[model samples]
Target: MRRALHKWGAAVVVAAGLASGGLVPNAIARTPENPSRVPPVALVTLPPEAQATHKLILAGGPFPYSKDGTVFGNRERLLPLNPRGYYREYTVKTPGLRHRGARRIVCGGTPPTKPDTCYYTSDHYASFQRIAP
Candidate 1:
């Protein structure tokens, strides 16, 4: 039937898109508590500013921005879900920027310094790549 063929064709198009990474953009793939879809970046691969921010976070700061150690609500739900106050955000200084930039490091867990996981987002909170330790 023509209807059956159209349905089959749509499914094939979707399947091809998934296989080629055309349809499912990072935002759509990254779901709450399912960071498996999120990409991973090595610690050394991060920008120098991000690396420094990471260190400050572990050292419990002397953070440059007052909001550095504040809670990250993760309202975007790009990250794995957790209780309130679980995630803390830190700023990665952008070269020549007078104020806090979009680049940031967000880590989740207790004790501030030793987070169970950390993520880097160059485009603010639009997307996150898990930091592989």
Candidate 2:
């Protein structure tokens, strides 16, 4: 039992290191300037039915509009009707601006019967530009 446990621990450590990209060959190493953001796109295409369903869902309501939008709800429990499902608020820097200000972004989720939208605020949520699709 003791020997088996030791081997299992070593295997776990090896698996973790490989998962973190430590096992990649030096020839295919990535540069510091251009880091990978997303995984490679799949070459084999989805069937027409699957593709159509995906398009419908992606095109569904609560589309992610801007980066500034707000996101609420714990990962475990999410409610669509709540305002938390719609938008997110963020701060971004503008040209000639010493500091950043509040901005709102839309969240992508299941399509609502009536799409919920958010507006970008210039003066700290005082006003907003109603973004329409």
Candidate 3:
């Protein structure tokens, strides 16, 4: 009878230790939720000369050229120029005409490949200029 009681008591102590040591599986971890926020969009228009200048700048030319072919005195400053939304960068590559061969270059945002392509904005996207290339 005594041996039986000792065995039972030891078993009870082991079970209690296991329970307090987190052997159970129902415990849950807490996590935070994401915030709700949306950025605004800007609208801008450029003159004929500015548009032409922008295009010339896009093309590898007399304009200040960065390794990425972006015509900006300071890239960091240009990025946040428009406060409304995030500024996206893009690169376009096209086959040159006849002997022209192939051309690969980077541009701000996304520009239309066709000559008749045009863009318009209402808020000031920092500074707006036409891409003539």
Candidate 4:
């Protein structure tokens, strides 16, 4: 019985991961209606630079980068679907980088400063994890 449960348990784990929108290693799973529900990253857990960037976002930044508060195309589609201009991107300062690094904060909503949701990406938009309020 133990061996039987172990054999079936792998499938159960994968199923549970899918149901909870968690990634199953080496598996490709996504749909237009169900874009990947990326995991959430706690506000306090973020790097100091990211934390500062988040504050700047809420404070209506006088951002360092010219493109800090520009529209994020979301071309990678890793983020949840939103119409054009619904998302905006801001830079997260990366130490030792002369130019803007991969780290960024992408917020979605109107008025820019007051966003409905925010996400953080360290991989140049290749992936994003929602920033938990």
The C-alpha RMSD of each candidate to the native structure, in angstroms, is 8.1, 19.3, 23.7, 9.3
| Number of the top TM-score candidate | 4
* Model 1: lDDT of residue 40: 94
Positional deviation of 100 in candidate 1, in angstroms?
0.4
Displacement of residue 30 (Cα, Å) in model 2 is 53
In candidate 1, what are the lDDT values of residues 1-133, reduced to their tens digit?
Answer: 1111122121111122455545544323333324335579998999999999999999998999989989998876677778999999999999999989899999999899999999999999877899997
Error of 3 at 14 (Å): 64
lDDT of 3 by residue, 65-115 (tens): 233233332132322233322232222222243321222222334332222
- Weakest lDDT window of 10 consecutive positions for candidate 1: 1-10
Winning model by lDDT: 4
Candidate 4 residue runs with Cα over 4 Å from true position? 1-28
Regarding TM-score, does 2 or 4 come out ahead?
A: 4
Q: Indicate the residue-level lDDT of 74 in model 4.
A: 75
Task: Give the least accurate 10-residue stretch of model 4, judged by summed lDDT.
Answer: 1-10
Candidate 4 residue-wise lDDT, 27-105, digit = tens: 4344445556688999999999999999999999889999988998876666777899999999998999999989999
Task: Give the alpha-carbon lDDT of every model.
Answer: 0.79, 0.32, 0.28, 0.79
* Residue 65 displacement (Å), model 1: 0.4
